[model samples]
Target: MNYTDEEICTQYGDRPKDNRGAVSPPIYQTSLFTFDTFEAFTHAQLYERENYVYTRGVNPTTELLEEKLALLERGEKCKCFGSGMGAISSVFFSLLKSGDHVLFVNNIYGPTQQLLEHLQNFNIEHSFSNGDVESDIKPHTKLIYVESPGTMLMKVVDLRKISTIAKKHGIYTAIDNTWATPIFQKPITLGFDLSIHSLTKYIGGHSDVVGGAVVGTHELIDRIFTYGFQLNGSVLSPQDASLIIRGLRTLPLRMKQHQDNCLRVIQYLTTKEEVLKINHPSQWKGGAFSFIDDQMTGYSGLLSIELKEGGFKKVAAFINQLSIFKIGVSWGGYESLVNSPIKENNELELIEQGIGTGIIRFSIGLEGSDLVIADLEKGFQALHSIKS
Candidate 1:
């Protein structure tokens, strides 16, 4: 039977079978696998089979996760990496050469900016645009890299428009879909060449693993699997792979709770006197809300809140006073966490551009909305308390 996306998500997204019917995927944590002979190892490597000749190239545990990811993204193939940056860097290295031009959104995750820095040193040319349809894309642009509803800043770009433009120019299109996750948005369905993820976030769902993935057409993925992954030696560990697989099973349930709690917290913040701006996509129809409405079925656990009266001191105070939310760097775990986005990070361009100064990001967890809102209330109270 042809299943709806939701049905497929239930059946395949969280397959209920164990190796011995144990009800959970086993963690195959071996570094090497035995081959029948040298010829078998050669064939496995040459043919790109899942039979593990080496863990750095492929592992059975990681391969299963990749298969599930390919299904989720609706791509012909997928590959996993040690970290999100690894996945991103592999894609870039595989596609671009010296003097090739890539058009990119400036508002992506900080490490993507770092990747471009290395690319520039390697003699690749690039253009930075707003990633909106209105922006001008020059001829000879070999690729268009997009990050939708950029997490740290909460800016949404039109992926479909950019994808259409890239196709017209014969330019490949890639997106960082970490914030939206497959449950919320599927960039491949919108005609992107590749959809990448920092699976450490929502896919892992528990802040336990640092892994990344790339999904694309079979031809492109085959090339990446061989050249980008096999050569780079940054494959996901079998243990981390198993953790991510477990996390994926609970993603839909966790997401529903995350959204419910985040919406309540956002509502509370929006009505507060200390708030200057609230940057949740569900706030309207065409602005930020429009992007979420048009592109995503539901918002993830992430959101950014901007306060007018608070600088670093207020942000720090708020973070310190939180009872339920923890202070940490990454999000999309079972626990709620808050961090300063506009703080002084080593990323100088981001700091100078006012991207990381008066903003605080919240990764709402699977907590009770009323309790989470109460915790936020205490934070606001502390912020005002210090000022008073």
Candidate 2:
């Protein structure tokens, strides 16, 4: 039988076997596991993905987390890692050979792009999908990587169309599904081959832990484990896995408040003279093709805004005046965060990405909308002071 995301999050992994019938799963914090006999030990080592002989291959705590994640993404298997890049790198190394090409769609994570650029040294090639994704495909293109409702511009492309295109050319498809999480968009159901996520964001919920995961069929995930995962030597600690497990129980509730607070902030920004354009999936007014409602159940609190004025000095002054919203490099926590791509000397690059020189990204937190709005008022006042 099928279960709701909340049910799966809260009670899917109900173990009644041990630990005084503890309601919360305990961390099996040891680095190694033992068996009754040499025969059993040798047998378990052969199927390390399932049986735990060493923590490097599997731990009871981290394995439990992986089970829930695989079910959440509607995939047959999953592998947890130390960070989001770990999962991405695993997919790349496991699937692509030295001569293969990669096609990236929408605005990918900056570090992901950097990793691909570094792969150029090893003879791997990558191209960003500018206008037509299908047109950018080369004979050697083996993967189509994407980030929908992209973190920066918030532009979303049609996933089904992209998946169909990739399948036609026999290319594997993967999406950085961190922004939507499994609560909003499930890529496998939409016909993609793999779905990857950064658990450090919404999954960890409190910004306390860093983790990553990839969900797909057993065949594909096994390939990643054999070639990319074990060799890369990235492991999600049992303690961190336990923390993420705690975060999972309240994901639905936190997501609702996040979207609610973000909507209020968007509403307030619409009335401000200092605001030029607001970029969000839920707030799309049809200028660009953002068909989110049909694909995703909801949007995260993250969104970007273009200021009426331009340049880094102006935007920096506004960010500095904010009392509640901290200027942080990461998001997906209880406290709100603000960041921007408008650097002091990257105007040409910003223009090329279709970004204004005064764009700012906000990750609205669980704090009441009133407080967030009040903090934003302070930022606006700073801009006004600069004008005077």
- Model 2 per-residue lDDT at 155: 80
Q: What is the C-alpha lDDT of each candidate?
A: 0.80, 0.90
| Candidate 1 Cα misplacement greater than 4 A, ranges | 1-18, 131-135, 287-292, 344-356
Please write out the lDDT profile of model 1 over residues 37-109, one tens digit for every residue.
Answer: 8888788877655566778877777878897888888888999999999999889989988888778774677
Choose the strongest candidate by lDDT.
2
* Model 2 misplaced stretches (Cα beyond 4 Å): 285-290
State the lDDT at 140 in candidate 1.
Answer: 56
Clashing pairs in 2: none
TM-score winner: 2
In candidate 2, what are the lDDT values of residues 187-207, reduced to their tens digit? 899899999999999988999
Residue 180 shift from truth in candidate 1, angstroms: 1.1
What is the alpha-carbon RMSD of candidate 1 to the true structure?
2.7
Question: RMSD to native for every prediction?
Answer: 2.7, 1.5
